[model samples]
Target: MIGGCAPIDAGGSGGGGSDGGARGDGGGSTGVNPLDNPKGTERGLGVIKSAKDLAEAIKIIEKVPTKGRGPKTGYDRDEFGYAWADNAEEIPLAHNGCDTRNDILARDGEKLKYRSGSNCVLVSMTLDDPYTSKTIEWTKQDASEVQIDHVMPLSYDWQMGASRWSRSKRVQIANDPLNLMPVDGSANSSKGDSGPATWLPPAKGIRCSYVVRFAQVALKYDLPVTAPDKDAMLTQCR
Candidate 1:
């Protein structure tokens, strides 16, 4: 989570792209498109299908313990030292048969201008930042401002359970679409390595939906959460 809270330009909301728009799949139709209707949000998976479903999920999520599931404090001089990407360059863009960053850039950016279909270097685009409910005007949308933020920050994963993961498995988790989203630069930076207990989206109205997705992602990845943190998520999601 962001180590300190920062006030943001909280006013204004604008619609940028259609949620129903079609996305490229690398192959003809083999890849899954988010618009095809999100499945696997079953009750057993902590998704809210109804009021009762929400209540039930909240109860289960709240009962989850807290201390053993979070990252180690004083991990270094900084609270977020482990949060920054590690071995990013050595990870090799070609390992996945393509670059993971470009794949996400194209997946998350609109009106993307690509180069030779070999890499995801966008010339222009509009970005819908999920965390702040704001549209970032990306003249070049390049790599800096438009970041593929892990919904659950990686450092949090490393300490909780990922420290033991194999390198390839870690890479897969790093690039998994379910855990990634395009977000505003400042918002993503502010979130750092915090979890649901300490941080959340700036758009207050959508907190329930946001927390629901957080729980789903954590559950899917078999990541653990602290008790207070889990309670906070359930309360927010409810």
Candidate 2:
């Protein structure tokens, strides 16, 4: 219903709910349709539909620039605060409260093995990681092994500019699909709270896309960035 979902195919053996597909268009790379997904992207939600949509989103975020003494200069603070609540709590199973971990489970998990429509019990679910570009062999395991990474770590946000966000804004950042990506557990752990300047994905080729999304989120949220982060993002954007 988020208009961004654009319902491609709800039928698939992978899960009972909607199955996300890739947006590909056989043309120039610039012509790449964010909605032209031929191979499913295991997206947290989906890509922004157009420059206009992206611009609109940016307008909203710019009004809420990051404030305060952000998270520890280097550590990726989970300091996102209230804006993170909606995705972390306000959605469907939100009554009990939503944590970053479970929120991603519901958003990224295929069947969403939940406790009978409640955010209570978390069970097994299939996750096709998009960052590592690998499908994790299906298995039932501990929660730590299966994790949800904040693409722009909350800690990073704290220093970069998230420290000043109102709870409402933080919740928005937490839930925004553009800011979230499902990746390998170990990779997520290793990359914990690091930014483009300090870290880059092991899959070098994906860096362009990765920065693109990061810029999309930062610009959308009006979050601040050091000169290096801005330069890196601009370079990637080009």
TM-score of each: 0.64, 0.60
Residue pairs in clash, model 1? 1-193, 1-194, 65-227, 66-226, 66-227
Candidate 2: give its CA RMSD in angstroms: 7.9
Best-fitting candidate, measured by lDDT? 1
TM-score of 2: 0.60
TM-score of 1: 0.64
- List candidate 1 stretches off by more than 4 Å: 1-97, 116-119
Q: For candidate 1, lDDT tens digit of each residue in 175-196?
A: 5555666667787888897887
- Stretches > 4 Å off in candidate 2: 1-100, 115-122, 138-140
The lDDT, on a scale of 0 to 1, for candidate 1 is: 0.51
Q: Quote the lDDT for 87 in model 2.
A: 47
The global C-alpha lDDT for each of the candidates, from Candidate 1 onward, is 0.51, 0.49
Candidate 2 lDDT tens digits, 45-144: 3323345644543443333333333447533334454433434433232323544445545455555455555543456666655555455543346656
